[model samples]
Target: MSEEQLNFDFFAELSEPVPEPAPVKENVDGADEISVEPAALSEAAAKAESSPETERGVTPFVLRQAVLGYLAGQQPTAVGIRVPTRVKKFQVSMAACWIAPQSKQNHIEKVVAIDIFDRREHCLPDCAEREELLATLKTLKLEKLKLEKVIRENEPELKDSDDLFEEFQSYDYSASRNTAYHKLLKQISRLQHVIYKGSRMELIRQAAVADYLYLAVPAGELAPEELADGWGLLHVFPDRQVKVVKVASRQQCNEEGRRHLALNIAATSLKSVLFANGVAVDEHLRVSFQPPPRRRRKRL
Candidate 1:
């Protein structure tokens, strides 16, 4: 792509007028509701501004704010944050819905998936140190297993002791050993983060929830090729400005998938409102209102 094409202005494209399709009457509830485009972006920006900055500087929350602003300027029908995708256990960071002019049915227009790299993940140790760390972690796991077995074997003997300190001392392990085990675990966690690269893009592709998919990252953090084929690249700057590094190619989404994505966005939007009003949603999708605790008044 040329420089102009690479730096495409998505908002300008969205603002351009397109021929409206023939109106067809459809029995869809809430089809005539006003678009929540600007309000959603404002809410997202407010939360991002209220949050403290991360150690590495620009946080995922800030990036989300920029992307939402970008989407809002384009005038989508509705926008949602952390929206669940059609794929189980996977969600897009942000999704925008657009209504089809002909049928007036809501469909997902854009989906953005963000990937933030933490300092530990970015500053992973060299290959030699990584191998050593893995080896140490393995040794620590074996030692932990042996210690657990010893504790289980001595459980009968310790059952008679009522003193907690005495029972802790009987475990035949030093405090330093416990500390080292936890340290190794932390290192292993960072190692896993470095190893599992592009996992976000993989999930976005698997979800395949929108007509246009975008991979958003902190400015100067990713190359255009880092995104999957047909996916767009959005660079979110520290000042909360969004730039389209690469335009996304339209993907085929059946009507069923579009409707499902739109429904997920609607559910997420509703849940946000309910939570704001002190209502809770359970795992089974049942909602309950919880009143705030009453404060006792002090008498003069």
Candidate 2:
């Protein structure tokens, strides 16, 4: 083919350039940003979408199983473990060290879940350690028996025994009038620990009958409605002097709330409070009570 004929063919081929398709538009407002496509969800995603798995719905049996399974892989003295699944969204669920009062089992495992489910809300478990409904009622009845025993022991003061109520205001009066009995209840409460079920939130307060107590709490999300007297529960319990209470209440608080309430009860009742921060007990668990340093008088 002649050079002129080849040049003409090349020019003819170059004349029909391919046209590029227009870029896809995401927002109708003429923004260059494209729409974010949702990721394809897996089975885990499907379960999450179907229903919220929080501490509330989690059973003690399931929690015990999970803790045992988890601990089997770790040290027996391990304090806590983070659960990746079976927790409410935007929450951290943990199983921590606890002791059962009924059995005096050391390092008893308990579950705790926390998030800001309700900003204004606070929760407290009634008592700790797993006791049957009848057992607890019977225990309360025993409190009555103890009170009667105290009255009988001090026979001369039976008429004024009712006045003992005035002196035991600081005690947890859920059962009896004796200061010793209230102290026993506090001990029982201290031994009691909280468990985070599958969907519930837990809270702890600085005071049992706090009008507006400082709280360390956990839940799914802290919403504004949960606040009680301008107190929003937050999760920042220290890892020492901590106890859990499995209190029997009309309603159950989530694990986090129960933890906070238990810690507060421990702090006020026992002169010290510790939190289970997923760390095993060590030298750090010991909290010493030191007197304030005396100031030296200025030399005249």
Candidate 3:
């Protein structure tokens, strides 16, 4: 079969709809919201058409499997998927370690973070914006405290607990304070979301306890400009082929970091094995194995 035909056959097996560019819409104020330009949208569509992975159904799971195979080929001493890093919130999609040739105790570790590139804006704030948002959140919290004080001062003194409850329900001050509290809460929640998304890169940097870091995505989905410096890029194809686009720069990993990475991989692998064996973990995190019931022999 021709290479082109083979490639087509591979993509035909998978079924996933390619994401379309979001249409521009006017806000409630009648102002046009910023969105992808017509030319950029058309260019993205053309690129997606040429790439079988994007055209077909190349999900994150499929891309992860391809990267796993590629990692296996490197013949690392140990490898794991969905491995937790030092930071609890962030996880390395794939992690591997190689034993140093000269030193049995030494290991060279590597980690990869995988993400699908969607054209939609994440609405993550820049450093200056994040600081401003944090300051606003702090101010709002202080204001909420002051409002709470006002509610307390306005509270009607009732000798009996029953009368206190009845009086509190009809208090105008309480009602007004409740409204202000909810408004402040909504603003705080929105700002928190923006801060979390904006801090993703920072979290990843803290989590990575490896000699090298890599970012993997579907071929043509990620742009070079989006990738962080010192990190490598791996392009996963629809045919389950992984191509290295950029070499990861080596980073310093102390003995502590290496040990931490190794322990995380081991713990994750142990959990996977226990689950595979049908070991049950209760809410308290106690593991127990239940043996299968033996079948009785039939008499002739």
What's each prediction's TM-score?
0.49, 0.19, 0.49
Candidate with the greatest TM-score versus the true structure? 3
lDDT of 1 at 94: 74
Where model 3 places Cα greater than 4 Å from the true spot, the runs are 1-56, 101-198, 285-300
Please give, for residues 1-300, the per-residue lDDT of candidate 2 as tens digits: 233321221101111112332332221221112222222213222333234333444332343343334334333222332222222231222322244444553322332322222111123212222233223323433453455455445543434443445432122234444676565444334222221111122222221221222222222323212222223233211111111111112223345544543343333322212332222334668554444445689999
Cα-based RMSD of the predictions, in order? 26.5, 31.4, 23.6
Measured by lDDT, the strongest candidate is: 1
Candidate 3 vs. true structure, TM-score: 0.49
Question: What is the Å distance of residue 113 in model 1 from its true position?
Answer: 6.4
Range of the 10 consecutive residues with the lowest summed lDDT in candidate 3:
9-18
Worst 10 residues of 1 by lDDT: 30-39
What would you estimate as the lDDT of candidate 2? 0.30
Clashes of 1: 0
Clashes in model 1: which pairs?
Answer: none
